[model samples]
Target: MTPRPTKKSPDRGDARIRLLEAARDIIRAKGFAATSVDDLCKAAEVTKGAFFHHFKSKEDLGVAAAEFWAETTSSLFVNAPYHQPADPLDRVLAYIAFRKAIIQGDLAEFTCLAGTMIQEVHASSDPIREACGRAILGHADTLVADIEAARQAHDIEGDWTAESLARHTQTVLQGAFILAKAGNDPEIARESLDHLDRYVRQLFKLTEENKC
Candidate 1:
């Protein structure tokens, strides 16, 4: 199905933002390679001229889309309720729980834009792949402090650093989305997160009953 844009039309000057929003939704559904410039223009309710005015090429738009994804999701995770917990471990677990909870509605709604884009363009486009990588890794960076804190608080012994574990969280999530897509079930994504939650719990020497 051709995914509908999140909005119909913006006021006169918001075309760029609308196009990026359209790219986020459409690319998540159809992927970067499959989604054409014409498709984006149609979804954004803008002309082809307007798209080229903002983005020099489709590749430029792909880079911008990845950066946009990073900025928007960064704000969301920063302000999320998961960060409210007093305990670092609680915060970490809460983050996992929050990820699991948000797996609702359409797959395109909850899946990572960067993940989808990177999987498709990683081999073919250097700039787009880097942009997508930065977005994914940068988001993973947000979890590092909390993971490190939990590690120290629990004196957790391991070969892994907070950074590696943080990236691993994304790995699990991206893999989960792939599984969800393959199985055509959102629960598959949630179930992968459940395993992630358990892994973190075990890493911190906490039991299932002790989960936050």
Candidate 2:
């Protein structure tokens, strides 16, 4: 949902793709446990037989949905406006800006699927949980290279590693989504991102007047 631009697609794709797309949106909105196979099938306009043909069980579909989320979202980041800046730190800050920029429409419209699924299924469903872990951590990992680049470029030295801070960005982001979901306000999430921006600036010894 972070990309927000392509909120929903036409129902022109094949059954498997249609189901995966439905799961992506439905699970983000309804939570993994509450969204049943029938709900997904109805949304995707597919039959139960088609659902089972593509996925063995709901758990299997959960895993596939996490994987699908990872695949679809990574492309958004790769070509995002965040990468336009010259300085690595600027790029990092731009990445945050891009994140905030995309937090539009309803809360469910912009929530993170992996973050949502992992929280719901971590204890009860290991396959889904692990799949979510890979999606979340994989996204976190994407930030490492840019973060490390910014660290080296700025000559930043700290007890913290780029890897940890990169992971932390996701931590704050996911937490923001959780708050927004509970509060029924998207601003709650954007406000957390505001703090995230300030925290990252603080980490890099940036005063407000001089921050990227």
Candidate 3:
């Protein structure tokens, strides 16, 4: 058999991760338009050459950062410990609790990086807009699956289908983040989610009779 190629050093991966994390922190603090390649390089502690070696352009880095953030944030749902409970409503409630904790936590990072970037770059950059769309779509799809499972588990009654509800939920959450960022209050975000919680509770009440 041919000899195995040498293992790629982890340094590159580490550098990339550092760059993405730095980008997230910087973008969260400053909008995409205000953030520059130099800022990212300084924040990441990597040289401009190193940054360019991994990313073709600042726009490219923005796209990659969106994907990186999506993948990282999606893990919160995918790897959540709560998978089972008699009431499917409980799983959904657990998800809401997790979301609340994320918003109210110390970092107090309000809106999504992709959302912020999209708002800043949508007028000028097709790539960034597309990246933000994909990030949002991925999140909506994940929510759809969970909502469907919860609906089936509890037999909830609503006029909307899983996908519709999923989109609605995503809209509410995104708007909540915007409000939170604009108002500089995580409590506002939590308040926005409260409406959703009420809706879910109503559905749960109706479905109780259908429980096996």
Candidate 4:
């Protein structure tokens, strides 16, 4: 979640913000099915009344949390250094490098909340699942312009479109997070991204030094 503007209360304004923050962290750690309204209330230090005041139900809050995840992470990537490169291929590689660089903290800290939530609730709740799908695909869509530009610049031909390749990055990332969590090692995630970086370079016929 974005930084809270103030430490105000539910009645004073910020109950909704607190609840979304609590849901993002706790849901990533515990899975959406396992995280209850009470758990969120306790984590946010808000009461049941406050939670319901902000959200009609836990499912409602789940959807809101996914939207919140998209908003905050979108801001993070928009201002990221990867976008500074003049070469589209360089920008793509830098994106992969940036993903690798940020895998330095706890699983919940760096892993995606939308990815985690969707895996748990996709089968049961359409609303939450759709929210997660939007968050994941929306972020993936941001990469399409760079990927397509690189393809065009190199006159590259492939069976894949920029849209599919962009989504593939998220696929690799989500899988990498799962493997890292299962093995309790962040290196596993980094290794997966290394392979993703190589794949992108190979697709564009670019050498390591070509990255700007």
Candidate 5:
């Protein structure tokens, strides 16, 4: 009987994914400006030839990593309980609750990769900055749509617009994540959300009056 030819494993594809994951970690720990192709290779335990084979340059890898972060994390927000709430305001509150849970539970120590990179690289690397900008704006749009839905659902009266609320929510959350990382305390994020929750209450009351 003739021996069947052996099939090669798909190690190259796996290596590319490994390099991506390692790049995320390294960039998260050391801002994009500080991270280098050599650092990524060492983190992934791969060679320069392999890294270059998968990515054209360090900037190329940064762009890919930013896209990955957006796709993955934005899905989390889009799929969370925010959209399924009983009403619009409740839905927005639910989104905050979702973030609070992330802080207290499984996602405790991990700061937001997109937010971190945006703060560090938005003024510098155009590709990464653009990617980060898209991620932030996409997430904000989702939140804004949710807020608009709630405004219609509960018939709330308010002077504020959904766009404003969404932008405010995103900024507060991003700032909280930074403070949490710096202080090494997840509660800091939750505490920031508490203030946001209070602001929501005031807005809700104003909306009830149609003063907005």
Candidate 6:
């Protein structure tokens, strides 16, 4: 049986959104190759004809799914509470803590949609892989501002640019998901995120008192 990835469903007649939602959830639980158009149609409760009307092929759906995931998730980060902190450094740490706090339930529930898809199909599906890459890097760009601000305010001189550090968060996160899946526990992923938090703290040269 295909994993039931989500309970949310779009309103009737919104076939495209249903399919896209189904694609995002199911593809995370099941690899892209293992997740078929029929699986998506069944999860979406949409007929095959309806699926075809919106997407010409499963690969097309995959591309659209990656884009949809980017749009939806990027919006979430934009308004997240972590950005509320006044200090840029505090915001950066809060961002990492926010990432840590969300690790719960089944691996599929918390793991990234784009990371899961590209990990499996990057070799064979150029369009889907590129779409996933954009989704990942696009989100990484959001952190650059805070990281750059923190670096400038602290006069933190280093070879690393804020852009590279921002992308590293994704690298560590995607790796964390893989490790979590392999270890069969969500806590395993949190362990990696903990290391990330400490690493960021060290870079900022925060003492024990300043950390608070």
Q: Which candidate number maximizes lDDT?
A: 1
TM-score of decoy 5: 0.83
Q: For every model shown, what is its TM-score relative to the native structure?
A: 0.95, 0.93, 0.83, 0.93, 0.83, 0.94
Off by over 4 Å in 5: 1-10, 104-108, 157-159, 206-212
- Model 6 spans with C-alpha error above 4 angstroms: 1-12
Clashing pairs for model 4 are none
List ranges where model 3 is wrong by over 4 Å: 1-13, 105-110, 204-212
lDDT of 1 by residue, 1-212 (tens): 12345555568588898889889998998989899999999888899999999999999999999998898777778788999989999999999998998898898989989999999889999999999999999989999999999998888988999999999999999999999999989999999999999899888988758656
Clash tally, candidates in order:
0, 0, 0, 0, 6, 0
RMSD of 1: 2.5
Better of 3 and 4 by TM-score: 4
| Model 1 misplacement above 4 A | 1-8
lDDT, each prediction:
0.90, 0.88, 0.74, 0.88, 0.74, 0.88
Q: Give the TM-score of candidate 1.
A: 0.95
Worst 10 contiguous positions by lDDT, candidate 3: 1-10
Worst 10 residues of 6 by lDDT: 1-10
Q: Give a tens-digit lDDT track for model 3, residues 128-169.
A: 899988988777777666678778876776787878876777
For candidate 6, write residues 19-110 as lDDT tens digits: 88788787778878899988998988889999999998999999999999898877677878999988899999999988988888788778
- The sequence of per-residue lDDT tens digits that candidate 5 reaches over residues 1-212 is 01111323336657676677776676766777788888877777678999999899887888888787777676666667667756667778878777677775323335666777778877778998898778777778887877887778767766788988988988998899888778877788889998888788776764555522
Q: Mind giving the per-residue lDDT tens digits that candidate 4 earns over 1-212?
A: 23333344556377788888888888877889899999998878788998989888889999999999999889889999999989898899999999999897778878889999888888999999999999999999999999999899889998999999999999999999999999999999999999998888888877758654
Question: Where does candidate 5 have its weakest 10-residue lDDT segment?
Answer: 1-10
